[model samples]
Every structure is written in C-alpha cells, then in structure tokens.
Target chain A: MGEPLLVQSPGVPGSPVVTVAPGWAFAAVAVLGALVVVAAMLDGALSARSAGGPAGGAARPFGEVARLMRQRRRTTVQADSLLWRIGGAGLLVAAALMVAVVPLGRWTIFDLDVGVMWFNAMDVMVWALVWLTGWGANSAYSLVGGYRFLAHGLGYELPLMFALVAPAIAAQSLNVGKVAAAQEGLWFAVWMPVAFLVYLLGVAAFSVWGPFAPALGSDVAGGVRAELSGVDRLVFEAGRYALLAAGAAFSVPMFLGGGAGPVLPDWAWVLLKTLAVLWLLVWLRRRLPAFRPDMFLEVGWLVLLPAVLVQDLLVAVLAVWRT
Target chain B: MDMSPGGIPLAEGGEDRDGLQLDVLKVRLGPVLPHWPAGLVLHCALQGDVVTEVRAEVLDAGDEGRDDADALARALDNLVSVLALAGWEGAAAQARRIRDAALETGDRPEDLEGLERLRRRVRRSWTLRWSLRGLRPLTEEEVRHHGLPPDAVGDTYDRLIRMMDRAATGTRQDDRPVFRVEHLALLVIGLDLAAARLVLASLDVHELQADHTQHEVAHG
Candidate 1:
C-alpha cells in the first residue's frame, strides 16, 4: 500500500522525481496553455448557455483573441508602460515558475527540495503582479481595482499560507513529491477538508477568478484591465486562466494524491485530475457572486483562518502519532 | 504649486476619514460606464478609492417622458446590472436573457417562468445575499430625505429582492417618486467606489431625468 504509485525514472537516485531536461519546459508550458484554453472554452460555453445562446460560445475565445490581436494598443496619460507590460506578462511567468517544482508523474523539471514553498512563493508574487498591472494603467478606476486586490490579499493570503502548512505538516516535509508520497492510501483533501476548501478559495483568490474578481468588476469598467486593450489585454487575460490552470495542477500533488490512480498511467491521471479541478473552478464562476473586499476581510480573518488552523493542528497531531 | 503632468492637474491634499492627509484625485464615474444609468455622470473627489466629495450630472435627458411600455424590461435590465455587479455572472446572464425576451416578445409565459426561476435562484444564493447584505441601508426617513422612492427603504440586498418583485409583478406604483440625477451624488458619498456602484444599481433608477444644475455633496 505504501509503494510509490509511479515507477521513478533514472536520474536522481534518492529524489522522488527525475529532473527532465530544460527543453521539456516548453512541453510543460504547452500543457498549461491547453488547460487554459479548455477552461476558457468551457467558461464561454457556460456563459452562452446562461445567456440563452446556442453552443457556439466555445468559439468566442478564439474570436476574442483575433479581435484583440488586430486592435490597437491603448496607452493612458502618464502611464508607466514598462511596469505595466511586466505586470501584464508576469502572471504567465509566475504560473510557469510554480509548475517548475510540480512533478508530473515520475518526471519533473527542476525538482527543488522545498517545492511546496516554491509554489507558495509564486502565488505571493501574484499580489505584486496584479497590483502593478493596476498601478501601471495610471487610471483612477484601475488604481481602485488594484487596491481592492490588495485588500483581498490581506484577507486570503494568511489563511492560504496556513492551508499550505497542513500538507507539509502531515508529510513532515516541505517537498511536494514527498508530501504526495506520504498520502499513500489517503488524500490530504479528504481528511483536512477545511484546508482543502481554503486552498481552493485561495487559488481562486490569487487567480482573480470567480468570486475574488472584484478587482476586475464591471462597475469599475473592467477594473484592473479597465484600460488594457489590444494584445496586452489578451495576454493579461490568458495569464489569469493560466494561473487558474496552474493552481489546479499544483493541487493534485498537494491535496488530491498526485499521480495516484488505477488502470490509466500516472501522467494521464495527473492530467485528468487537473482537468477536473480546472473545470470545477471555471464552472464555479457562474454559480457565485463576487466577494466584497470589506465583507470578505472579516470572513477571511474570522472564519477561514481559524478553520484552516484547526485542520493544520489535527494533521500535526496525526503526523506525530504516526511517527 | 500648480503642476500638470500630461495635461492633467495634480491631485490636491485633503484630510481622509482616518484624519490622515491624503491626495484627493478628481475622477468621473461615467455617463457611459457599463451597468451605470445611461446618462448619469458622477464627478467625484476620491481619497484612496473612497468618495470624499461628489457632484452629479445627466446628459441628453430629452423632453420625452418615461416609456411606460418598457418599464418591465427596464426593471429586468436593472436587475441584470445589480446581479452582474454582485459577480454572479450565471444569474446575471439568466436575468439578461429574460430581459431580452421580455423586450423582444413582451409578456411571454416562458419569460415569466424564467424570471420566477431566476428570482428564486437569486434569493436562494446565500453568497449573493451575504455579499449584498447591509450595504447602504436607507431608512424611510433617509429615503424621503434623499427624495428616493419608498422601495429604496432597505439595504442593498433588500432593494435587490424588491427589484426582482417589481419585475415579476410589473407593478409601477404611482406614489414611487422620480429619482433625479442629483440624489446620486449625495447617496454615494462616504462609500468606496464599488459599494457606491452597487447602491446605485440597487435603486433601479429607471425614470432618472437629467438635471443640469450642479449640486455638490458635502465632504465629510
């Protein structure tokens, strides 16, 4: 029962993952892009269904890309162009960097020891990137949108950090592969449900997806993306979907028993699990309302923080007893 | 010190709600913004996203009175705005569909059924309820003071449900007074931009007319 789910390939002797060559990073990015596309397509279809349109909404993403690509780049008065571009482009990079530590099945690129913390750091980088995107626009609405994200960050970040601690505590190792390995028969999500739920909320929060999307609310005229136009808007939006996809991918190892399944190969299971999670996140967008930053701050601090902390405590006690 | 960068005047400093001196930037919330009243423009003095001061105006408010035929559709359209602002896209889209159907086909039974389903769904949404609850509650006196309709008596959430009810029943009460553009500036003061937008959307100001007279809301 404790045997490794997938056979480790030849590379590092003691490591749970084989460090694939640098060229494989492109393949990883392609997978991330595919997940992003699928999520976008699904969201488009759902939107159309709700709006009483035919199933033709799946093609909306492609149409939008073409339209944006051909459109002119918009610039604001006194806009800090460099920082804006960086913030716009940095989300995809952060998502890429996060997946660097995530082991696919038996193979992983850049098998860092503290992979969980690496993923955490990348998410924290989102705080800066989104705000920078907001600030660089030099528009009043965009700036307000940026501040709203920071307010949400203050609420979600702590609880998210503690949620990460649960798996690390139960596994007694910060390494994500090791953590996945520790969950031989039991997934962390099944036992520490509070942490799992908070982690999902955190993922949604950091991705600026669904309920945590007041930063891009319609009232603020697209909020952070208020002034973004042309290819710049396209890239910024792609980055958001990519972040959501990456978050779902990372959760496989952290919570859902990574690469652990029957009949199908390990990599296939990982992809399937990721697709399921990504679909859930995208579907959730239609179901919930936006969380008001001020009201959410209280819920984050009062409810989510305490609940996840208790989950971590329970996991900690169980880990110690097992040892 | 008068300095204009990129032809825009620099923001002036003012005491914020926290008693800290902060830069107050003048920003306009649209006559053309999405989900906003069609011709209303709110010129505001913002200190860190909070509306410290405001002035309201409306553009192109012609002599033509309200279109009584489209009142139900307009009510549904306002519901769409409130739902969309609340971040419930599915429900917003559902409301939009019903609204569009109402506009196209008038009082179809299918549209009415859809509206009923949407009303129940929105009411059942604890998340939506939680998000909209207790935001900008206007008492009866406050409503009268603002010259707003009696329907605007409750908080944003209550107003939202009442808006749904208004759409469902198609009851345009004669006692319900017209909402002028000037009242917007007064109502939105002291709230942050998002909440202010929510409050405005909840009012379902279908009969709003342009009042060219500029009225300044006192800075607290």
Candidate 2:
C-alpha cells in the first residue's frame, strides 16, 4: 500500500509528474496487452516446433483471429443467448478493465486509490464470467466446467486475497502506484516470496491456464468452452489469453517493482518485465500437471492460505519495526 | 419422456446431493468429443456435474483381424488420445507424429527409434503419471476375473506405462486372450467424469470390441 495518486505524483517531491493523456494511455495499454497475448501464442507454437510437433506459422494467432472473424455464429435452442454473449465477450472486457489500473512505466489509465483492490475485484469477476460461459451453453459438459471453476475459485480465493494483502501491508497503501513506489529500494518478490508465489498460483487459477486448467480441461471435452463455436469460441478463448496477459502485467507492479530499471525508459522496462513474467507462466504449462480440484482444495486451504497469512503477518511486523 | 424447450431430450427427475428432488441430466460423453476415443459413447445420469450412473458402449465395432502393425498403430493412436487428454499438447503432437510415421514404415529400426523416444518421454513425464496414477486401480483378481490383456491388467498408470512399453517393443498376441468391454464399467462407474475419461483413455477402448451387435448376431 503506497501513496494514493489523487493528490500527489507517485515519486518523491520536487520531480514533475510525467503523465500521458488519457486516450494515449488507454490505447497504449490495449496494444501492449494484445501484443503480450500474441507473443505467448507464438511461444507455444515455437515450443511445439522444438518438441518435433506440428509447427504453425508465426502468424498463426493472427490467422486464427481472422478465421474466427469470418466464421458464422452458432446457436442452440433454449440456450441462454444473452448470458452466453455477455460471458463470451466479458472476458476480454474484464481483462481490459483490469489492465486499465496497471501502470506501464508509471502511466496508468486510472490511478485509483485502491488499484490493488480493483485488480483483485476484476479477477473475482472471472469466476462468474467463466461460470456464465458454461451455464449459458445449455449443455452438460459446460455446466460441469462451470461447477468445477466455482470449486476452483473457492480453493484459490483465500490465498490470493491474502497475497494481495501482503503487498498492501508492505506499502501501507492499497494503491498500485504506491505499492510499486514502495518497492524502489528492494522488490517485494525478494522479501515476500511466498506471497509472490501464491499470487502467481492465483493468477494461473483465475486465468485457467497451465495446471489450473481443469475448468477448461480436455477430459470434459474442453469443459466450459465445449459448446462454443465460431465467434463465440474465438471471443471466449481470446478472453482467457487476455486475462492471462492482464495477470502477467499486474505482477510487475505487485512484485517486481513496476518499471524500475536502468538505461531504458520506464515503459520499455515495463514491457520487458511483463513479457518475462508472461513467458514463465506459459512455460509452466509444459512443466507441471494440472492440479486435481480435490487435491488442490486441500493444498489451498490447509497449506497455501496459511503460508500467505504468515507471510502477511511477517510483512506487517517488519513494517511496524521499520517505522 | 419430457423434452427441454431447447428441443433436446431430458431424462427423468431424481434426488440430488441435497436430498432435494432434481432432474437427472442424461448427457452423452462422446462419439465426437475432442481427445475422446473414436466411436465411444457414454450415457450418463447426472445430478449436477457428478455422474450418478453411466453406461459405456461403442457405436461401431471395429473389423476383426488386426495384425501386429495394426495393433501398434492402435496403441499409438490411444497414446495420442491419452496425452492430449492429459493436456500435454506438445507430447500429444509428438505422439501423433510418431503414430503417422509408424503407419508409414512398419517395423523399421528408424521408426522403432522414434517409438523408443516417445516411450521414454511419456514414461518420464511425472505430470502424465501424476494425472493418471491411483485412478481406477484394478486389483489383480479383477484383472483375471474380467479377462483383461496382460498389459492392461494393472491400474490406469501401470496400463499406460505398459502401453508405452508395448508401443516401443511390438505387442505379442497372447494364446489365451481375454478382452472385454464390460470391464470398463468397473473402472469407470465410481470415478468423476475427468478421471473416468482418463481411465478409459488409458484402456484405449477404441481398439477393443465394445458393440453388442457382434455378440448378439453370433448368439442368434
């Protein structure tokens, strides 16, 4: 929890506020977020190539986008069309909204007083969004996927909230800008490793990627996205990747000291750092097995939750001792 | 036989987890689901996402008389399905590549080398093993009583490892053979939908005789 950006600039006094226009900042974040998702897809294709698998062209992601754009919409009778539409597009919308609060080199679209809470709130929104995607399908597998995600959300939410609390406790502010500013001396990741690790776990859980992908698992025939086709499928998948990008972007402010670096402009450092975090998350998919919801439930509540709480407690004590 | 307004047929109502009366959804797992074995259909009774009951049946009976080459192809195909289901897309693709190559050049040392590599990679995957282990464990008695293949006599994990082994070193047909589709019920009935699918994938039921028509015709 660092200084709120409402009344004062992010840095120490005497430096002029280097802020971008609202439209420019919004545009920049949108482009950067989209690019990050594309880069991740390319990395996946490249990994497949190295492993002697099917090698898609570098433009595969874009080609997919174009293909989905041209595909016809599919509908089932008695399906919750309104809910389905909302859920399909809502992922991308939520990701964009979440990224609005994240600083790309100290130029956030909205430097709200409670940026961290906003980030957390958007992630929580994914629970309903994913469930709606499943429920709207009017099919069994999708409904099961929706049910699985809720169980998964129940498991991960406590630890994630606690992890968010640790960084807030360190900065003594819930503001994202302040959290990043407070980390100028030493990154929160170095000091609060447990919280950072839990945060990453939470990111994977919400994004439904890598090991936490049971909600969209192949076992249930692509789970929540089972019935989606044409543009609906495209939007839902794009939204999932977008959420992954947003989560990767937020880790910059929350743990790795935002855009703090030498030589390069703050934005360049921000881009580089975000890509690094995104790559790590993508690579983890190949390395780890998906967590069984039952086993993960035990680990999240009994192990991870307690670990982050202790981490938070330690951070609290350290803050008190320093002041 | 009531139908939902969606024009999709619905199953009769049943008691749910809360002891409240809820309609049991009759969902079919596949004849067409991605990563699912081809021609397999599982009719399930669902109280929410939990499978209250299930009946497994294959839509089409594969033709009789599969040679060793055919067996290897079938094994590789099953390997691909299981890997895909386990979310190892890269490995699944690799398995697919190997499967394609095996089909092209049967029993060549070069092709055998690819199978060996695939076998090592699949066996070494802790994730794959972790996902499959302890799921639908079959007792030795169950294996004998049900007349499963020697390779499939173990649990899902063991069966998968054995499958990889067989894929690497060509399968040898047993003189006294016993393979039954009904045994799938024992392995699948109590497991959740995900685990059940994995168990079935490990069994690679696509290569087995599952249709009742052949038996019925023979008996008739």
Candidate 3:
C-alpha cells in the first residue's frame, strides 16, 4: 500500500520500533539557536566577510546585515503608501515561522506527527511571503523580484513534494522524525540516492543557489532586496539563514545517518553534519556557475521529476521485498 | 577587463571571465543637473602601453532603473567597446556587423508591425526571461491598460544603449537619482511614439563607440 506507516513494529530491548524521535529534532534546534547573529549582517559575505573558513573553524559567524541596520534608512518619496514597509516586515516574519517546523537533525521547534505535510505547507507559505516582499516594495526592481520568486516557486515546489516522499515509501512513515530513526539499518542515501541528491538540488533551487540564483544576485543587483534597508532587511536576511539551517536539519536525518555517530554524542554528530552540509553549500556557491531560471525549470520538470518518481518506485519494491 | 558596468578582476589567473585576464569596472556618478556638460567616467587598468583594461558606466542623460538584465547587457556592450578602444582590433567591428544585420531584419513597410518585430528580436531575448529573473516585459494588455504606449517597450533598448554611452561618464560613484526622468516620461507620452524615438536614437549608438566627452552624434 502507498500509505505511510510512521509508527510501526514496536522494537524493544534490541529491537527498535519505528517511532518519531522527538529528542533528535532538538539537535538541529541548537544550531538555529546559534546562527541568529550571522544572518543579520547585510554584506557579511562581501565587505563584512564570514571568517569561519576551515582555518578559522572556531571563528565568529558573518554579520553584514547587522552593520547595514545601523545606517540611516532611505525610501523613495513616491511611495503610494507605507505598504512596502509593512509588507516587508510581515513577509520576513512569516518565513521565519515557516522555518520553525522544518526539522534539522530530526529536531525542529516542534515536530508534528504529519512531518511531510508540515514541510509542504511551510514551503507554500514561503512562496507567498517572497511574492509579497517582491510586490510590496513598489519599485520596479522589487516588482520584478516578486514575480521572479513566483516563477522559482513553480520550478522547485512540486519536485520537492515527490522527492520527500521516497523515504515515506521505504519506511511507511510520513513523520520525518520516524523516517530518520528508521535509517539505523541503512541511511536513505544508500538505498534512495536519487531522492537524496534531488532533494538537495531542489532545496538549493528553492533557496536560490548555483545556476538557480538569478534572483537577488549581483547581476540583478540584489533583485528583491534592491530597495530594502535597515532592520527590515536584517530580518529578511536572518530568515534566510534560519531556512538554510532548517533545510540542513531535514536532509541530515533522511540522507545521512540522522543522529547516528561513533564516540561523539548524538547531538554533536548532528552539529558536525549540519556544518558539513552548510559548508558544502557555500563551497558550491564559490565553485559552480549560475544557471538561468528557464534552464532549471526545464531541468526540474523534465529530468528531476521523472528520476525521483522512479526512485520512489524502487523504494516501494524494496519495502515489500524486505517485509 | 574591458567593461562598462560590473568591473574587472585584476588578480592573475582569476577563475572569472572563463580565466581571461582583461577586467572592467562599472561606476555610477550621480543625480545630474541635466544642464551640465557630459563628462567621461573612466574605468582604467593598465598591463603596459597596450592598456589591458578599462570599463565605463555613464550616468547618462538619465537613468536605467536598477535592473540586472539591463545592467548586464549594458555591461556586455560596454565591455566590447572598451576592448576595441584598448586595441583589441576586431572586437568593435564584429559587434557592428551583428548590429547592422539585425538593423535590416527590423525595418519593414508597415510602421507599427515593423517596430513590434524588432522588439521581439533585437531589444532583448524573450527567452532571456527564463534566464534572468524580473526583467520580463509586460504583455500587450498589461502594458496598454496601464496607459504605456506600444513603443515604450523599445525604450528599454534605448535606455540601455543611452546608458552604455553616457551613464559611465555622467554618473559619479554617488550620483544617485530618486528616479529616471524616462520612467515618468513613459507615464506621459505612451509607448509607441516613445519606442520610435528610442529605436531611432539607438540605431546609430551600436555603430559608434561610446564617448562621453563628445556629444556630437558623429565623433572621433
């Protein structure tokens, strides 16, 4: 059956049951707690510069947005109303809350039993917020950004829905926490490699990385953020880091061994995994060329969609064959 | 390193520009008096007497609302011109060939249809919409009901070309304008008439190299 069985086969004393691991989700929560400062830097990656490269592994997080906040804000006099300011602040809040439910290292702010459904809802919400931020600014650049975000919404959203479902088939669980726990015998990345990679790619596309980063890039001259400044800009930037942390958390439990590690505490392993993934993403930004949105949309609908569907099917076969 | 907008990387064997050594810088001067004589904004770098790098960004007679697609295209055209001036030889000549051939494809017997055809091909790539976010032109309906003229769409090419020539020289690093006059202009005259003037103005722009010092259409 296609139905996901999140709580299954009560394993006791040597046999573990497929139940949602509530404690593990907090491992990701701790990481989010730590990144609250760096995301506030508006130009941290450039003039501000993040110093946490391998040589300075123990150094502080980047903070460009914070410095910008201290500067006096500027606004175009032709604004029809104060809607842009309100809209900017509102959308940032919405996106921050959306990141709350998404599990990092199996721990989210609070994981509901319907983990897959929660994540999907949050993504759709983010789509709306980005559009709002784009539209509210009233400037031409912001209008274009809002519309661009909607197009990106079209490209990555559905494929992500399919990719997240592969583990549900293997474990018969919709609870992301449960799905992570089931990775003890084998990490989903081992058996469901396509879903793992596609999901990361999808996440990257959603988050505006690699070739999919036409929005808010140097080329567009900070497309959506073209007009934003001060504290409002800081919040928007902060929300991005939170989202990144949340994505790393969700993927870790599914693709890697979740909290499974040797010698180190489970939570420490989770932190290491989160940092590793975050580092990998930053590295990709420096290494790969930016892709056009049209190119990725074609890739998403044509190639990634079909591949993830097949991977889902394979996981189904394996589930039945093993049972 | 010859560019007008996004500047050049001076570091040797830099990974950018596909590992090419040339570099250029984009500089914005300021909100202008409009009466002031057009001055040149020079993006200068030297690799000996051959003049290895220079890019120009003009403040222009006005502004091109901060758009990346617009900026990149302006940068691209500027880069080509700067390379030619710096003794790259065939660079400027090759650009003129493409622009001239494109000029023919655009001219037709009818006034309006001829203009629309040019907007589709020469102005910018509609397919480019998929490549860059937020630069897509409004549909005929969206543009019209808003009271924008049919030709106003072509004005983007005009504005970009104008920027190629003037924005580099006229705008200083701090020459920030509250808004471009053209944005307000489109609101007044409508698009088709606006588009014609812009197109006519741009026709010669591609043929000659950009020079802010000389305002005369034909320059040395």
Q: A181, model 2: CA deviation in Å?
A: 1.3
Model 2, residue A20: what's the lDDT? 44
For model 1, the DockQ equals: 0.79
Candidate 2 Cα deviation (angstroms), residue A276: 1.2
Question: What TM-score results for chain B when candidate 3 is compared with the true chain B?
Answer: 0.21
True contacts kept of each: 0.91, 0.41, 0.05
Docking class of 3: incorrect
The CAPRI class of candidate 2 is acceptable
lDDT values for all models: 0.86, 0.76, 0.48
Model 2 per-residue lDDT tens digits across residues A1-323 = 23224344453333222334566655755665665556557665766574665576455677777887898877766789889889878998888888887777766666677888998889999988999999998878888888888888899999999999999999988778788888977999999999999999898889888788888887787889988988888878878778878888889988999889999987788878888888788777766657776457877899999999999999999999999
As for candidate 2, its clashing pairs are A1-A168, A1-A171, A1-A173, A2-A178
Candidate 1 local lDDT, residue A313:
88
For candidate 1, write residues B1-220 as lDDT tens digits.
5598999888789999999999898998777878888778889999988999999877764444445447777788889999988888999999888887887777743346588889889889998889888899989998988878787888999999998898888876556565566777888899998899899999876444422222222221
Runs of candidate 2 with Cα error greater than 4 angstroms are: A1-21, A47-56, B1-3, B9-13, B17-22, B32-35, B108-111, B114-120, B150-154, B210-220
**Each prediction's DockQ?**
0.79, 0.47, 0.05
Per residue, candidate 1 scores C-alpha lDDT tens digits across A1-323 of 12233434453346766777777888889999999899999988988888888788998999999999999998999999999999999999999998887888766877777888899999999999999999999998898899899999999999999999999999888877888888889999999999999999999999999999999988888889999999999999999999999999999999999999999878888899999999999999888999998788999999999999989889999988989
Model 1 Cα shift for residue A181 (angstroms): 0.9
Q: Interface RMSD for every prediction, one decimal?
A: 0.9, 2.6, 17.6
| Candidate 2 residue lDDT tens string, B30-71 | 777766766667788887676778787767655667667777
